[model samples]
Target: MSCMKTAENVCSTGIRIKDKKLTWKRSWQKYKYLYFLILPGLVYLIIFRYIPMYGLAIAFQDFTVFGGVFGSPFAGLKNFKTLMSNTLFWQAFVNTIRISGLKLIFAFPAPIVFALLLNEIFHPKYRRVVQTISYLPHFVSWVVLAGLLDVFINSSNGVLIMLLKSLKFNPPNIMTSNTWFVPMLIVTDIYKNVGYSSIVYLAAISSIDLGLYESAVIDGASRFRQVWHITIPSMLPIICILLIFNLGNILDGGFSQIFVLYNSLVYRTADIIDTYVYRVGIVSSDYSIGAAAQFFKSLIGMFLIIGANYTVRLFDQKGLW
Candidate 1:
């Protein structure tokens, strides 16, 4: 009986080794090309993203450039308390929510609606031209666009400001004014991104079965009716999923646009977490405190993403798990 058990154990070990080898060989045979394709992306994520995550330790310490991440003394929650106590931080927090909320309200639907409008266009050549024109601004750098925006809204010399002045209007510097900061962010963001954003909707629209539209046409449905019932509903799932993802990013605001466009004049209304972090960390060299601020921002983002995903799942089972 002992001899038989030993022989069985040896046989099992041999099978396990064979299975491991076979599995490796099969995987290589089936997906070697795919693995090669993914290798660079994996390396990029590891090097650029994963490696930098080590810096998160700065959030816990009274860190300095000389002190380094581990060399610094722990400050407990003092940085957090300082963050909470600051009136400016609260104001910036409110602005982040308000600005991002407004953008979501207007900008989110703009692309979907624009895509629907464009999809209704029957002329292929004109549609292509419109697509190209609309897409052009998205590729334009925020720095260049900010400069152009400055040209259009310069209080003394911009085209629109000049026009307003001609009309006997005391035009505000829309680019630098507190009252216009959030509005400017939303409008410019929509302008730059709406077409590119609409591309997804366009793809979704184009993928809908042509048969559905034909059947609707046969049923005496007008074009508008078909779009309302057929097109909109067909795109709802993609919209919802994209919306779920977008909600996670709303607090980010437009860091680049806001940073480029804003001055001390609009800082009260325009300061976002990212810009604040940059100012605190790199500009001011308050490494430890900046890390704390950044950590706070990341925590909020994490909650936003999780909460948004949860809400989406509650409303619709098709959600990110």
Candidate 2:
């Protein structure tokens, strides 16, 4: 009787497993096209993002081109220790924090404010024209934009310099000046990205129920009050999500922009982790140190993302979890 009961239970479990497989197979068949649509993106992420993560192990090893990642001798935390002791690395780290913080404080909100202002515009044509003009800069390559900036602000022959000279005002060489380099970076970054970034906020704003605004109007709430109470509150989730994402990228510090714009004269102000890593890793061929820097940056970014998400959750706000 015991043996018979055991056989019956095994049979039932087997049947349940088969049923689940069949259900999964049917669902896959139904949504095969959707899966197919995402396959390319999945492949790209796997190939470019996930596969490259394996190379990060080099940070723990004395990596050499001929020795390769597998053949490299393990150094454990030696590279990271070296990085910590290096004054240049610390300077770059501090500069990255300062520049990224400045951008977060100033550039991050430019898009939101721009989007809100645009939403208030009654003229659709004019709004589109403004958006198009603003977005055009984002499509321009940083290399090209940097060159344009150099020309436009050239201390000797720049259009800005000429204009300032006309007014009997001396215009400093902004591109080389440590005092102006960071501010220039922030302003240019905001100018380039504000339009593209605002699109998400605009979409968020559009999804807000018009009935809320109408109800507010009926309650004699002013436009500012309605926006403050309804629009901002409605967009808070997205805003929080974006803020968390930005926090994760705190160390990035606009590598492409800085690389193209900065020279030795401005490295004091403009040098960042990415640029420093590129110089140490690729240019200097110190692969382990470079990898260590990147690994450190990634670690900090992960902690920041987790911290930001937890902080948001504490406020009873939705996070990227």
Candidate 3:
């Protein structure tokens, strides 16, 4: 007891039971309003995000519906081995990477470029309108947009095909073609969220000291030169931060969009882990296998997030921690 007391005294700065309780009391008193506001979100994450973690144990079991989660006999390494040997699962994984890769290559940079261009516009009313129009799509649900996209890209009555036919050119309905899935993914993602994504960059740009721009203008720097020399460089830290955040999701294939837009016609290239999980798990009633696949996806996501944070720290010396 004496030795334990001595160690505790030496480490007194660390959180002890009484100290932690007092700290919580102080924090609660100081930020009661903020805590109140965050209570709902805290409950939400706990209910939707954290609580569902119990289902993950199915990945290790036979997980029959009749036997139930706890009643199911444990079958260690069985489901995981099956996942490893499955060709279709691998194909779906590859498609997810391809779609997400294209999104990063095209969708990410387009918003930054758009934000930069908008920042340069001198017309106030036009700028606000542009921002409003651009930001609007981010609020639209994929369920609605997928139906609209189907209508707009229908081979017979679609706008693009109609315009092309008017010019004596015939283009295939790209939505159902494997060859166009990648570009479609990029274009649709960019069109939907680029405006809202640019909000961060716009905020970063606004925070940059205006005096730098004034000095650049006095030196006769052209608008393009000013943006290239001052704006992008000033925005580098935030850009890197955003890039790191994006890199952490290199495998998420935007499940809702793909599920709504895709049919077997494009499954060769369009199918992703998420959609495959739905088909094989819910439709086929293979809960164990589905849980295994989900576990793998979560593992990959964790690695990507850690790797991205590490890369950002290496380049900029700051990370989420």
User: Candidate 1: where are CA atoms >4 Å away?
Assistant: 1-44
**Which candidate number would show the highest lDDT if scored against the true structure?**
2
> Positional deviation of 40 in candidate 2, in angstroms?
6.9
For model 1, give the 10-residue run with minimal summed lDDT.
Answer: 1-10
Q: Give the TM-score of candidate 2.
A: 0.87
On a 0 to 100 scale, what is the lDDT of residue 304 in model 1?
84
lDDT of 3 by residue, 7-31 (tens): 6345444554435544668768756
True-structure lDDT of candidate 1: 0.83
Candidates in descending lDDT order: 2, 3, 1
* Model 1 Cα lDDT, one tens digit per residue, 38-73: 999999999898766778777777886777877888
Compared with the true structure, all predictions reach lDDT values of 0.83, 0.91, 0.86
Model 1 earns a TM-score of 0.86
The backbone clash count of each candidate, in order, is 0, 0, 0
TM-score of each: 0.86, 0.87, 0.86
RMSD to truth, every model: 7.9, 7.5, 6.2
